[model samples]
Target: MAKEETVLQGMIDRLIEIGRCYGMEMNVEKTKLMKISRQPTPATIKIDQKQLENVKCFKYFGSLLTDDGRCSCEIKSRMAMAKAAFSKKKNLFTSKLDLNLRKKLVKCYISSIALYGAEIRTLRAVDQKHSESFEMWCWRRMEKISWTDYVRNEEVLFRVSEQRNILHEIRKWKANWIGRVLRRNCLLKEVIEGKIEGRV
Candidate 1:
């Protein structure tokens, strides 16, 4: 059994209004309507607002809406949509660290580690003091990272360096779209939650 799309929209609107009356506003800029039920599915309804973190409050009410009816799959499927909506409402921003930049950074870092070779211990020792070299080189358009990790010589001696090219590549792709939206939403949520207060 399922509810009609129009009816669902109406219910959502009413809930939004109620929330506003309580001094909490719905993010109208990110609101959207969609049909998720069969054309003639019964009177059942499902409402979810867990991902609407940008809104001060996300309230829903309906006899047909139930908690047990929502499955994990449904929640996971809509997570990206919710993130995107939050991004829109909050106008979140992210740095444009393109793929090329990431690739160069990883490649150079890995190469430095490789130079230390099979005698990983010695390589790790040299890395302790000269790690800044990589960042400096990168700062000069050579690709680098400004890391502030302090550890004893013994710890660095056992440090193993491995190639993470594929992982970095995947990150680049995600950052351009889904990753960017999710990160922005998370940052916006933090700002709204009193954890971090300032203009996003």
Candidate 2:
């Protein structure tokens, strides 16, 4: 606690000093400190002698990051946002529209939002379940299938002329990221290569 607090305070003090030099001061009231740790200790982090609030979760890159490295919150948040996107454009997607066009719109708008930052997450089984279910939910809505209709997810995908491979899409993205990282001679590659605890 003491070490992190001192470091944070030092950073804040330096920022304030630099801002004074540039004649542009930061709003201490608006500044917040978010420490990423699974086990966080209570510490009063001050900015400009004013206490900055410590947040449990912070938004980064488009995903919600918590102190714990779990994807449940991110999955739920994405689902809610995706449902909102779908509901907002529900009127525009008419029944008379071509099935292919409806599928295209769902993929382009809704899926893009739901899966925006999913590639970086180390997804658990339940996280993947939510992602797959969300995809089928959108497909069913586009095909106008309801609970009353005894239709399976595969049937919904078939009706919409879509592929039942949302999980593979995420895997493909992860693979692409790994490929890029492997080819780069940078910090990420060095960090990954430096940690070699197991060799067989």
Candidate 3:
């Protein structure tokens, strides 16, 4: 492990040198280090005698990534963002438009927000339950139904003429992504198939 850290530090040094040749300097204060592992240990990586900040979680390409490699936090973040987006367009969803059109809008707009990066998510039972609940919540809110209304989830689906398809949609995306990766000859395929050496 110490040897690997030394190699990483050497590589960072080379990168810094190359960036300097291009007149680009790395912002040590803005840079963060996150060690992704089942059991992450503290990693100290320094640049120019300054240490980078370590984070338990950070957003990368708009998706939350954590040290534990779990997607629950990302899922919750997506759900909250989706709910806020729904609230912003509440009028359109609850408008007197055709029910089918409203449902389409929800699927096109809200689901896209909630399911962003879901294809790569590893969901547990609790996560799946949360996703289903979020789906039902969207429908209920669109129908203007309150929790006190005691409306069953099925009733909400019935009113919307939709079924619980969030999980199915996620599975479909995973399948498509896997198929595409498998068809290509790339490092990602090797990583996915565990062909890379020294992988944790």
How do all the candidates rank in terms of TM-score, highest first?
Answer: 3, 2, 1
Candidate number that wins on TM-score, 1 or 2: 2
Per-residue lDDT, model 3, residue 89, is 97
lDDT of each: 0.39, 0.78, 0.90
Candidate 2: Cα lDDT at 197 = 36
Off by over 4 Å in 1: 1-9, 12-34, 37-175
Error of 1 at 25 (Å): 23
Off by over 4 Å in 3: 1-3, 186-200
In model 1, residue pairs whose N, Cα or C atoms come closer than 3 Å (at least 3 residues apart or on different chains), thus clashing, are 2-42, 138-143, 138-144
Candidate 1 overall lDDT versus native: 0.39
TM-score of each: 0.20, 0.80, 0.87
lDDT of 2: 0.78
Q: Residue 144: error of model 1 in Å?
A: 44
Structural RMSD, model 2: 6.2
* Ten residues in sequence with the least summed lDDT for candidate 3: 1-10
By lDDT, the better pick of 2 and 3 is 3
